[model samples]
Target: MIKTLIIDEETVNVLSYASIKPLWFTDYQIPLSLEQRIKRVQISDKLFLISEKTTSESKLLVIKVNSNGIFSELDNKDKSIAFDRVITIALSQFGESISPGKGWGRYVSGKKLSIYATKRTQKNKNRLYFDTSPIDTNHIFAYALDSNNNGFENIEVDESLFLDSVTLIDEAINSSWQNTVEADDKTQYGIELTEDLYRSFGECLNFEQWYENKLTNEQRSFVDKSYDEPVRLKGAAGTGKTLALAVKILKDAYRFETEKKQKRLLFVTHSFVTAQLVEDMLNSMDSEMNWKFLEHVKIKIVSLYDLAQELLNYNLKKFTPISKDGKEGRKLQFEILEEVLTKKLLEAKFKVGVLGKCGDNFKSAMESKESRKPLLLEILNEFACVLDAENIVMGSDNGDKYLTSSRENWQMHLPTEHERRAVLELHMGFRKYLKDLNVLSMDQMIADLNRYLMSHEWNHICEDEGYDGVFVDELHCFTRPERMVFHELFRLNKSFETKKLPLFMAYDIKQSVDDNFICTVKKGSGSALINSTNVGKTNLVELTQVFRYTPEIAKFLSDLDGSFPALDLASEWSELTLKTNTPSGAIPKLSLYSDPVDLIDNVFKLASRQARSLSGKKTVAILCSNFDLFEEYLIAGRIKKYYEPISSRDDVTKLGRLKGKCIFSMPEYVAGLQFDMVYLINLDKVEVDEDNPSCGAYRRFVSRVYLGASRAKEELHISACESRQGYSPILQPALSSNSLLMS
Candidate 1:
C-alpha cells in the first residue's frame, strides 16, 4: 500500500525545488510503465520515486514508492553503496543525451543532496533527498536545482520543480558531493551507509599570484624582454622597479637555459632588507616552475658589501676589517696626526720661523680638543677625497685627474716645504699604521678588490667564466667607487660571445639619501660610472609608470624632487586606488605644530588609523633623522611593545622585526622598503635653501625627504616643529600649494 506525505512551505523551501529530466530513462532498465510513472527520484543505496502528487486543502501530498529501485546496493545488510557509484548510475540515466561536460559531482547537506554536471559554458545541476517517518505516514523525495547565469532555457526537465534563476556557480554546494555522511538506520525506510568520502580540489594561489595579477602590459613587456647587453632601468618612486627586476631575472634564467648547460645570475642590492625582499621574490617565482629545472640556473641575491667581503676572502686569506662601532675611524686618525704635528712643533721649538706662515692657527687648533674636531673632520674629508679619486677601482686617467683636482680644492694652507712634508708624512704614517694591524676598512677593501680584479688571474678567470647576468636594485645608493668596482668586476668581460652578458640596474636617483653614498650618475657630467652615453655599450630604459601612489601623491613626490623625471600612471594603478581606502583627491598631509608633543600625538593617531585599514602582515613606520629621537618617540608613544627600532648601521641584522609591527627607522635604512603609512618626523632639522640651487645641503635635504616620502605606498603624514631649522627651500612650492593639505 502506498501512503501520502503532507509537506509544508518551510520543508519545501529547505528541500529547494529543482527539475530533474529523464533524458536516458532506458539506461535505468526499469519497465517502461514504471519509468513513465517515475516523476522524481531520490538517490542512495536504494532509489525512491514520487510517482504522483496531489494538493490537499492546506498541504501537498506526495507519494514515493521503491518497487525494484533501479540502483543496485553493494551491501544489502546495511543497505549501503559508494556515493560515486550512485552518481555514476544517475548520470548514466541521462547518457549521451546530456553532454556531461567536465564530468559530474555532488554535494550533500544532512538529508539533502546537490549534484551538478559542470561545463565550460554552462552547468546542469540537481538536488535530491528521500525520507520516511511513521508520523508523516509516507516517504517524501525532494529535489533542488539552479543554473549559472548561462541561461536555463536550454535545460530540459521531465518531472521536476524549477528554482529561481539565480546564479549558483559560486554556491559551495556544487562541489559538496565530495563528502558523504551516513543516514540514521531507523529512518523508517530510507537507506543508511556509514562511510567517509571527501576530496579537496581546485588550484590554490599564494600572495605573489594576487600581486602579479595586476602587472601592467608595458611592465610585463619590459620584464619579458630578453636583453643582449647591459640595461639600466631608471624610474621614480612607486614605479615597480624591484618587481620588474625580479621578473626579468626569472625570464633571463629560463630563456638562457640549455640542455646540458646553465647560467648564473647575481642580484645585488644596497641593504639586507632589500636583498631579503628580492630573494623572497625570486624563491616565489622559482616555485612556480619545476625545481629541478632551476637547479642549473643558480641565483644569488646579496648586498654590495656582502659581495665585497666574499670576493676579498675568496683566496683563503683573512683580511679582517677593524670594527669602529659608530666611529668612522677618523677621530683616531686625527689623534695620530695631531701627535705627529705636536712632536714636529716641539722639535721646531713651536717657532713660526721653522714651520709655515699658517702654522700658528693649526698649532692652536691641534692643541685644544674642542677646536680640533672640525679641523680634523676637514682633514679626514680631504684625505678620503684623495683616496677615493686615486683608488685602483677607477680608470687610471680619471683617477689621476681627480687626485689633481682634490689637491687644487684643498682649503688649508701649508705654505712652507717642511710643513707640507710633515703633513704628507702623517698621511703616509696613518696608512702604514692601518696596514700593520692587518685591518682593512671598507675603503681599503674596495681598493683591494679593485687591484685584485685588475690582476692577471682575475682577467684570465673572467675570460673563461663570468656571471651571465648581474641585477642590481637600489642602484642609486652606490657611490662612484662602488659603481666602478661593480663595473670592473662584472662588465670587464673581454670576450663578447653570441650573447653579451646583461648588467641590469634599477634605481631612482631621487631616493639616494645618504650623503656619503649618493648616486654616481648625478655626481657630474663625467662622474657617471653607469651612463648609457658615457658607456656606449649600455642601454637605458626608464620605467615611467608609477604603481605605488595615486596621481596626487605622485605629483607631490615629483614636486619634492624638482629634478626627478616625470612619470605616467600605471594601468594597474587603478587596482591600487581600489585597495587604498583614502578618499579621492587626498594629497600628502603636511602639518606644522607649535608643540612637539602634539606633533607626535597627531602622527600616532594617523598611524593607528591607517594600520586598521591594512592587513596584519602590512607594516607601518615612524621615520626620524636619528636614533636618539626615534627612541624618545618610541618610548613616549607608549608603543614600544608593538614597534621595533631598526638600526641605520651597515651591518644591521634586525630584519626579523619588520613584519606585523610598527618600525622606528632612519631615512637611510628604510630605502627599498614600503609601509602602508609613514610618519616622517623631524623635518624641521633638515637644512635647505631656496635661493641656492647649487647648495649641497639643499640637495641632500631634498634627497632625504624624497626617500622618506616614497617609503609610503598609501599615506604620508609629515610633521615639523615650528621652531626647528626646517627642510629645504625646494619643498617651498609643495608646501605653498593648496592641494598639499597642510594642517
Candidate 2:
C-alpha cells in the first residue's frame, strides 16, 4: 500500500521508489534544485508528478513497479508496470489533482494507495526492480498548510483507494495547479512537511535523536539552561565545557528558527584549532539543517584574534597585523628598545637609579650566553604580560597614571624608577613604531577595537541585531586586553533599558594554562577585568559533575588539588566527583627510566602495544610539558608513521580517523579531548618548590599535570627519569598513597 507521495513537472521518470510500502507524494513539477531533490530522498521515497500538456480529454501516464501487484491491465513481462487511466473517478473523488485520502475505484478491491512526485528522476524510471519484500502496513497522516492556497489540506493520505488514478485535469480552469507545481522551497510556499511526514506517518519522531550520544546530564543541563542575566560556567578539564558551549549555540539557533526570529550567536575561544573543533562538533549534531542561513543565526565560532580582524574588516590599508613571526614586529621593537636602553643605562653605568638600586646592562641582559641570540627575547616574553595589562589598563585612561599604578601588579621586577621609565619608554617607542608602520600587535588590535567601540560608529552594533548570546570557551586563557574586547562588545547592549546583555562564559581557573593569563577579577577584587561587577557573584555557576574521568583517575586528580591562596577556590575551582565506573582497568602506573631517550622510547613502545590489545580500537595520547622534546621523539621513533601529532593547528575533523594511534599533544590543548589511555611525560620538567613565590607557578604546573592525568579513560601512565631531574615533589603524594603502580 502507498500512503503519501510528491510529484513534479518536466517529469523524468526516476523509479527510486518502487517498493510496496506506505508511500507519500509530492508534485513532480515543483520547483526544487537537483541537490535538494537528492536530499529530499532521505526523508520521502515516492513522488507524484503531473503532466504539463494535460487537458480535459488528455490521458495519464502511470509508472509503478510490477511487484506492487497493482496494474493488471499492464503486462509485467518486462518487470515495470505502465498504464493509462481515466480521470473522471479520481478528479471527482479527490479534487482537481489526484492524491491520497480519497478513493480510486475498483483498484485492489478498495485497498489503500498513495501517490508522490519528484521534480527530477532519481534513477531510470523505465527500469523496475522486483522484490518478494514484505509490505509496510502502517499508515501515517500528517498535514501542514500549503502556501498554494489550494482548497484541500496538504495531508499525507492513506494508501487504500487503488485506482492508479493517472488524472487529467482542465488546464484553463485549474491554472493555480501549475503555480503550486512551480513554487520555490521557501516556507512561504508551504511548511516543509518532510520531517513531520517521515516521523508521524511511519513512526513517532524524535527531534532529539541527533543528541542521543555524547553529553551527560549535567552538560546537557548547562546547554539547555536559560538565564536572564550573564553567567560563567567553571569546570575542570574533560568536563565538556567546550562541547556544552557548542550545543548551547545549536539549541539557540534552533529556538530562533522556531520562533521566526533572527539567530545571532558569537562563540569566542583562544585557539583556532579549538574553534575548528567546536565547528566540527556542531556540524555533526545536525547535518540536515540548512547551513546556508548559518549566518542568519549569527553562528560565528572564531579565535579572539580572528574576531578582531573581522571587526576591523581585514583591510591592511586600515590596520596591518604585526608580522611577529618575521623580522618586522616585536623583534624589531625589541632591537630598538635594546639600543635605547643600552645607551641610557651605559650613561647611568648600569644604574642604580636615584635609589642606587642596580639592574642589568642592556648588552649583557639582551644576549643569552647559551643561545647566543637575545636573552632580551626571554625578558620580552615576560614583559608581554605587563605590556598586555598596561595596554588594556591604558584603554580606559592615558598611559601615565595607569602605568604608574600597574607597575606593582606586573609579573616581573622593575624595582628602580629608571627601569620603570625604560619599560614605559620601550612601550612608547613600540607604539610609535606601530603607528608609523600602520600595524598593530594582537593586544594593540584589541586596544584599538576597544577605542573604536567607544565612538559613535559603535552605535550601529548597539542598535542593530547582534548576538543574542555570547559564549566564551577557555575563558580562563583570556588576558586583560583580550577580555577588554569582550567588555567593549558587551557594552553595545541590545537591551538599552536595563543596559544588560545575555552573555555566558565557561572557564576553569584551576585549568589556567599560564598564571599570567588569569582574570584579575578575583573574589575580593574591587574591580572586574570585564567590567561586570557580577563577576564571582550569583552569575557564576560551577559544574562539579565530572563525566569524562574514571573513578580511579578522579581519585588521583582530587589528591593532587592545591589551594590557590589568591583565589576564592570554592567559586573558581569546581570539585570533581566521578560520575563513571573504573571497570577493572589497570591501576595508574609510574614508569621510571634510566635516561630521557630511554623514557621516550619505552613510552612509544608501551602506547603501541596498548593500541593493539585494548579492544583494538582504543586511543592513546602522549601529554608533555615540552613540545621540543615531543617533536624530537616523533622524528627519532618515526612516531608520525604510527600516529598523528595534534598539538598544532590542523583540521580537527580528521582526528576521529586517526583513533587507536598515539597522538602527541601539549598539556594546554588537552582541554576538552580524551583518550582511552594517557601518558603524562616530562614530569621532572615541573619543579614544585614550596618556599618560593613560584609556589603559585607550581600550582599551575600541578594543574596541567592533573589535566593530563584525568584524560585517561582506563589507564594512565606517568614516566620520569629520577636520575635526570629527580621525581617531582608534587607527584610524591600520589606515588606514596598506593594510588599509583610505581615501578
Candidate 3:
C-alpha cells in the first residue's frame, strides 16, 4: 500500500484529499518559499522514495505525519474506511498486544484513531500507543516500530526497516503534535469542524461537487476597499451582503490584531438571534484563528436592542427591557395596546350612536371585538414609528409638532389628522401604562438611548469608549431611531462631528419586512440612514451574485420582485439585481390543498420525503405565515416525531439541540437562518388583494413570502389551502412566468 504521499505547498493547497482512496499521509506544513524540487524514486507500486532538493545540500528527511491531523479533510465514508483499515492492520500484525479485552474490536470500530508515544521510563519502554480518544495520553500497546535515534537522518535501509522507520517517524510526529492538538481542542476545533461539514453539505446539496468560497470581483472590491465615510452594501436576498460584512469584519479584526492595534468594532443586528448567527458565522469563516484574541481588540457583536440596554445600564437608567420570550412578548404588547385603547375609548365616552372625530370606521373597529386586533396593530405601528420615534409626547409641544408635521409614512395607517390625534391619545395611554409598570418597549428603548447619547455627558463618555468602526446587518429592517443611534455610538472625530465613523451597512430594500423601515438612499430624504452623499463619497457596492441559492430560485425571486408593486416603486430609488452562481435547481412548487387539514398533511409528507432524500442530515424549515397556523401545528400529532419548534427567543444552544430535526417557525424568527429545504405553509393567511397591492398589508405579505421563500438554499415548497375564491393573487407573477410548479 502506498501509505505515504509527499507534496509541496502549492500542490497541498489544491489537493482533493478525499479522492485518494488508499490510506496515505502528506505534510501540509511545507513552506511555499522553499521551492524544493521533488523526485519520486519508485521502489514498488506501494513504496517510493521522494527525494527533496535543498539549497544548502540535499539530504533525506523522512517525516511521517500523523494521519489524524488530516482526518477531518476526508469525507465521512473515507474516514470510516481509513479507520477500519488501520485497526485491521494493527490486529493482524500484533494480535492481542493491540486488543485490550474481549469487546475491544467492536469498541474501537467506527471510532477515530489517535496515536501517542511514551518516553522510556524505568517501568516503560520507548513504544508507540494507540486509542480512540484523542485526548487520552496513555493507551494499550498496538505495535512498536523500533528506532535507535529520535529523529530522521540521511540513511539507506531495507524495505522492512524503511517501513518501521516510517512508523517510528509517525510516532515521533504524533508525540510533538499532541500539544498542538490540545491547544486546538481548547479553541473548539471539533465544533468548528462540524460546522464546516454542515456548510459543505449545504454547498453540495444541489451540485455534485463542492465549490470554493472564492468571492466575486465585486464582493472582493467591497470587502478589501478602505473607506473613511460610511459604505452601504445593497443586494437582494442571497446576494452575499451579509457574507461581505462578515468577511470585512474578519479581515479588519485580523489586520488590527497583526498590527497590535486595539480597535473597537461593533456588529449591530436587529435581534439577538441574528447577532448570535453572525457570531457563529465569523467563527466558522476562519476556524483556525483564535477568536479569543479579538476580545482584546474589542470586537463586539450585539443587537440594536442589546446595545440600547447596555447604554441604559451604563448610564444607570433603571428600566426593564421588553420580554423576548418568543411570541409571548408580542402577544403581551398587543394585549397592553388593547387595554390602553379601550381605556382611551371609555374616557372619550364614545358610544355606538355618538362617534368621536376619529370617524365611523375607527369607532366601529373599536366597538367590534373581532376588528379590534387589526386596529390595535395599526395603532401600535403608528405609535411606535411616528410618536415614539420622533419623541412626541402627547399633550405637549412635541405632540403639536407631530400633529402639524407631514405624515408621509403614516398615510397608510393613519391618514387623517383626526385619526392621528386618536392614535396619539392611545400612544399616551400606552406610555403611561408602561411607565407605571417600569417596562420599556423596543421603540421607546431605542429612542431613550438615542436621547441619552445626544447629551453632552454621553458625548464625553463616547469619546473615550466608543467604537472605531460599526457594521450593521439587515439595515433595511432598522427603524429611523435605531439607525440614528449608530452616529453617536462611534468615536467622535472633531473634523466630522455631524458625520459618522467608518460605518458599513448591508441592506436589501426588498427584504425590509417592517412597514416603518426607511428604504430610500436619496440625499436629504430623511428616510435612509446612509444618504447619496455618503454613498457617493465612500462606496455603495451593489452585489449581484446570489450564491446562497440556485439560479432557479433566483429567477423566481427576481420574477416576484418585478411583479410586486411596492418593490417596483422601491426600484426607482434602489436597484435589486439577482445573478446566481449556483447550478440549476428544481423549480419552486406551489401546492394548493383542499383545506387546512389536507395542507398540513401534504406539508409533512413532502418535508419527510425531502428529509429522507438528504439522508436525514440536512435541515428543513416549515414556516407559517400566521400565528394561528403556527400554534395549530404545534399540537399536530404527526409533527412531534419530525419537527421542532424554533422560537425567535431561542439562542444558539437551543438551535444546536434541533440540529438535524426539521424546524417549525415563522419567517421573522428565521430571518438570518438558512435551510436545505423550506416549506412555507399558509400562504393564504398572508392575505393580499390585487386591487390593493401597494397597501401596507400587501407590502408586508410580499415581504413575508419573499423572506420565507429565500430561506430555502436548495428547494422551496409553498403550500396554501384553496378557498372558494381560489389561490392568493401574490402567486400570480410566479405562476404566470412558470417560475413556480403547480403540484
- Which regions of candidate 3 are displaced past 4 Å? 1-213, 288-291, 294-296, 314-318, 323-332, 342-355, 365-378, 400-417, 498-500, 518-529, 532-538, 567-576, 609-615, 635-642, 651-653
Judging by TM-score against the true structure, name the best candidate: 3
Per-residue lDDT of candidate 3, residues 1-743 (tens digit): 33333222212211211222232233122222222322222222222222232111211222222342224334444443433333332332221111111111211221222222222335422222233221221111222222232321222223343344333322232231111222232332211112322223222211101112567777777787674777878777887777778778877777788888878888887755566556556655654335534645777777776576557762133355564222224446777988876666676453322337767788788778765665676666666656776788778998887766775632334556776676777777788898887677777877778788778878787766788888988877765566777766777645466554588988876666555453323223433445422322446777888888988888788777754554333332453467877888899998888888887777876676666567646778888876666878888897567666764443222343344556778887677677878998888843666776675567767788888889888898888887624467777778899998898
RMSD of each: 24.7, 19.3, 17.1
Best-to-worst order by lDDT is 3, 2, 1
Please list all clashing residue pairs in model 3, or write none if there are none: none
What are the models' TM-scores? 0.56, 0.61, 0.67
- Residue-level lDDT of model 1, residues 677-734, one tens digit each, is 7788777743444465544445556666778877776667777877665443455667
Cα deviation in Å at residue 343, candidate 3?
5.7
Identify the runs in model 2 with alpha carbons over 4 angstroms from their true place: 1-217, 291-296, 315-413, 425-439, 490-499, 519-538, 563-570, 574-576, 581-584, 609-616, 627-647, 650-661, 693-696
Q: Between candidates 1 and 2, which one is better according to TM-score?
A: 2
Candidate no. 2 TM-score: 0.61
